[model samples]
Target: MKNTIFTITLILVGLIATSCSSDSSDNNLNTAESLQAVTDLALSGTWVISSFIESGTDETDDFTGYVFTFNSDGSLVADNGTMTVSGTWSVTSDDSSDDDDDYDSDDDIDFNIFFAAPPTFEELTEDWDIVSRSASRIELIDISGGNGGTDTLTFEKN
Candidate 1:
């Protein structure tokens, strides 16, 4: 009788542990899905640069006149005068949302940047820290270290 009771207790403990593990995995998946949904909604539209502030500088370059087109197929094209640049972009990772209750605002909308420059059209990509995102606007921090200054670009849907 003692042997039978011990076996039953062990089996019950194993089942409970497995159940808890499965619940955690499900929670992770749901969180990921929620973040992806926001990204997909933000990607497919015409976004005009509402503001561009270069990091470390008090001067803010107003780009309210230009439009940035990001197609659903991951292509990018921007025209701000006679100059036009074409490139491609892909989401490297969906970090988390910018909810005041959950994650820090600074860590919100974090993702990567992929681009193909002119002449060769070779693909070049880098990680960009996204500052904030919504159905109508996206703010990204330029993480590329070069002559290009770090900038915060705010875009609005057109």
Candidate 2:
């Protein structure tokens, strides 16, 4: 009777442990379709720069009066009534690279921006990690590989 009870207890413990365990793969299984959903959300509306921090300094004023639009074609435009700047943007996921990158995870997603000219707008160009997002707001961050500085950018619906 004692041996049978011990065997049952061991089997129950094994079952409980298996039930409580989590699948790590599920956390790193970011798919392209989900990334497209995020891009679609950005394309849904226009936004304005609510905050910009570069190496602990706030620089949000640099984008004053500018409204940004992320189009479906990957074209990004910033208009400030008086002037307009054309750029490109993309939201991409790179699991393989993130495996070794300290700043990212296996399911890391990056928001990339590129502007050819205008030094002020050029400052926004980088592969920023998506911190959080909603219909009204989106937050991004980047840690410079060269300078070890942290930069943050936030966009809010305009």
Candidate 3:
């Protein structure tokens, strides 16, 4: 009788442990999916520079100069001149979603940081705040100077 009781107790403990483990695993998977969804909404493609403007200047140049790719692997290539500069980037958020204005009620959003680039403009090096994001469009603001303007960059999935 003692042996049987010990076996049943052990079995019950094992089952409880297994159940808890599976629940934890499910939570982890959900967290990963949430992160991927946010990244997909933010980064996973090519972004074209629709507009470029300097601070305190009425002059806005519609140059072919632009940034071509920003990858989730922290790699980026920007075409400013004849030269192509490459660097790693990082992303952060004031909260999980940076600013609420950048997303719809159903949208997920995040902020990104750019590092190690050629000194082109103070705006480029500064923290690029994602003002709004959607399936095909992204609005970014240069939070560098209080005078920083917004750029609406559009992309098609390639």
**Pairs in clash, predicted candidate 1:** none
RMSD value for candidate 1: 6.9
Cα lDDT tens digits for candidate 3, 27-102? 6666566556656664766666555555544322432555557777877676666867676555543334443443
**Tens-digit lDDT track of model 2 for 63-115:** 99999999989999999999999999998886655422454531467788999
Residue 52's lDDT in candidate 3: 50
Of 2 and 3, which scores higher on TM-score?
Answer: 2
Candidate closer to the true structure by TM-score (higher is better), 1 or 3: 1
Those runs of model 1 whose alpha carbons end farther than 4 Å from true positions after fitting are: 1-23, 58-64, 80-82, 94-110, 115-126, 142-151
TM-score of each: 0.56, 0.78, 0.50
| Greater-lDDT candidate between 1 and 3 | 1
Candidate 1 vs 2: which has more lDDT? 2
Sort order, TM-score high to low: 2, 1, 3
lDDT per residue for candidate 1 within 47-129, as digits (tens), equals 77666555555332434455667666767776667766677665543444332222224333344445565532221244446
Error of 3 at 115 (Å): 4.2
The best candidate by lDDT is: 2
